[model samples]
Target: MNTISAKYKKDFNMDKSIEEKLVIRNKRFQSRLMLGTGKYRNIKEAVESIEKSEASIITVAVRKIEYLKKIGKSNLIDFLDWNKLWLLPNTAGCQTAEEAVRLATLGIEMNKKLGQLENNFVKLEVISDSKYLLPDPIGTLKAAEYLVKRNFTVLPYIYPDPILAKQLEEIGCHTIMPLGSPIGSGQGLQNFYNIKVIIENTKVPIIVDAGIGQASEANAAMEIGASGILLNTAIAKSGQPKLMAEAMKLSVISGRKCYTSGIMTKQIQGQASSPYYGIPKLQ
Candidate 1:
């Protein structure tokens, strides 16, 4: 063996192969998958699917709670294992900066009301275009700025724009959530280059949110340096939600492993695994 190869062979350790846990602020998550609570057939299915996913974080839209309370029905929070999971309250229906800010404040209040004392994180979303459901960058930034000052860990969901991403990071957003495609479209990485650029340029965690259609898409997101993925419609709308949830769990892990292992580079031409010089001739 060559001197360099022989030297490194003696120092290689098998114990250092374990994947590192994902950390955002003070919390560390074993599963980087973040599932959303919406559009499920029922609460039972949602609970089963989420349990199968083994996700460490779950997003709950605060706007739906008031209606549920008014109708004398249980909300998503009533079924969640509050102590085990981190609940990320989102302003899903907010269309303006003022509305988003109000919802965020009310979300924290509801968090305390539900006995989730440590819940100060919010997914800031201000979507002006209801037809496409695209994020309003101006409103999102405005809401994020307001929330950060009030000591809320703001994770703004936005369109994949590098400049906006940088601006959000500069404004002290806890994490940057750039969408893979239009909300609930299940299109999968429509703006991959922009998303990659955002991942490379931003200092904060980049959790790809919305429009993930399949397990492979989730895997690809993690492979390309996303800190995590937030998904809902893909699993919730599937015929077998529980099984799809399990697939998502495995896919995220697979993608994370591939990323951690340092994937091999691509080549234009074929490379032989065995040496032709040592091979015997065929008759």
Candidate 2:
């Protein structure tokens, strides 16, 4: 049973700006910074870090829970806060269409606690490989098209391939996320130029997700006009996760500011600010 409790149909008809940019579930956020809610040592730390960062949204993975005979059962319920920032449940482990669909249905039911079904906010993460962790684009495309028909806010994580991005858009992804590097490698922007092209040509928000190593890299992505960034290990695995979260928050804001304000042009030949005409000896 596809028990989607997304209240969007009853409450939201999907609003658009005059420029037709899709409003984020009727929220006024032009900033493209997306945060992950995994890898924190504890739920409290995760919540506190995310809150302190002041991120507009946080992504969480919907996976399995093991039941211990001694301890009974405990899911990732510790991470749930119905009152916090918008919940973005990702199908992180699904590699096939069947798995994705089953999990997506479970997510809808599980998300009722977090109010996801009501809001229609879910990010689809379909990875086929356990080793390389490559997304099954075929599965992703199928899932994306299916989810869109079902009225879910779909964001797909993909490699820096522009045509795949276009295919995703064609199937109804509201935004496409191109990886900055491998997930959790902190390798920085490995496919920088391709990401730029994706950002340039995509109609939807072009989110640079994964493999961001530092605040400077986040800034670079924004400078290139990426809609926003989604990061995890870069902040979560930091020596001081809380402090790192704060740094990332400011970096995003600073990047947005720099991007909006045109950068100073690069020059190969030195063009003196004090002209030869202005210098007394030269004059």
Candidate 3:
């Protein structure tokens, strides 16, 4: 490690080789992973984790904060500190189509006041029941079609079914996010085969959101051709959140490299990688 580091440093600066460039939906990013802003200890800690994660898109909810609301800053947004992150306000906690649309519109209005949003698109979360808070596929489909008509780049979160993914794309969504498990479950890649099918079939970006317990899980998702991942509790709840964030970033990169390189095909018959008789080659 020391020898390689010294040699690389002598040839070219080591610090400059670390940072990577990422792009999504024509927006440039230094990282591919997107982090959710809920469940953080505080706004400061949230920002710290985001920085450490190197996530390009930061998912936030459109709910109002009463304290900030009384002072005419109802959304509790801090645009000044979030210059590097793309604001992806989600329609979280919305049980109905009307409610989700209103929240999406409100997010646009609030962020417009901040005056520097990179884009006007939003990440839509249309959850029906309050218990598990799982997404309503029917409601999500309806909302996505509507949002597309409204010229918004709708990124809809849904179950791991491919029919829903195709339906969302037909309805004009920019991306489809399927949960690996339930929200905040951290079970990690329970539906890997279906996810693989989705990646093989779909044209739009397929992101594996939720249920990623650790960096390895995220890496596996990337290796299977997922466009991106959304994580919050896994990092925020960890003892060393910032360190975990960096580890996740590297995992995604390595996984992506393997994905592009193409994995070796599996076989039913027994096959050996090593030569059976290495000394026979000398003859």
Clashing pairs in 3: none
Instruction: Decide which is better by TM-score, 1 or 2.
Output: 1
lDDT of each: 0.90, 0.75, 0.79
Off by over 4 Å in 2: 1-22, 64-81, 275-278
- Give one digit per residue, the lDDT tens place, for model 2 in 1-283: 3554577553344332211322554554534567886676866777677767777667777674312223675434555466655666778888887777766766676567655457666678888788867677788888888888888778888888999999988778888988988888898899999999998888888888999989999989988887778998887788888888888878877776677666788999988777576556744
For candidate 3, lDDT tens digit of each residue in 161-235? 888898888888878899988888888999899899888888888888988889999999999988788888888
lDDT of 2 at 212: 96
lDDT of 1: 0.90
Candidate 3: misplaced stretches above 4 Å?
1-23, 64-76, 269-283
Query: Regarding TM-score, does 1 or 3 come out ahead?
Result: 1
Give per-model CA RMSD: 3.6, 10.4, 5.4
- Candidate 2 colliding pairs: 5-117, 6-117, 7-118, 32-228
Question: How do all models score by TM-score?
Answer: 0.92, 0.83, 0.84
lDDT of 1 by residue, 1-283 (tens): 4355765764564324346777777777888999999999999999999999999989988888877888999877799887788888899999999999998998898778767787798999999998999999999999899899888989999999999999999988979999999999999999899999998998888999999999999999989888889999999999999999999999998888888778899999999887899678999
> By TM-score, highest first, what's the ranking?
1, 3, 2
Location of the lowest summed lDDT over 10 successive residues in candidate 1: 9-18
Candidate 1 vs. true structure, TM-score: 0.92
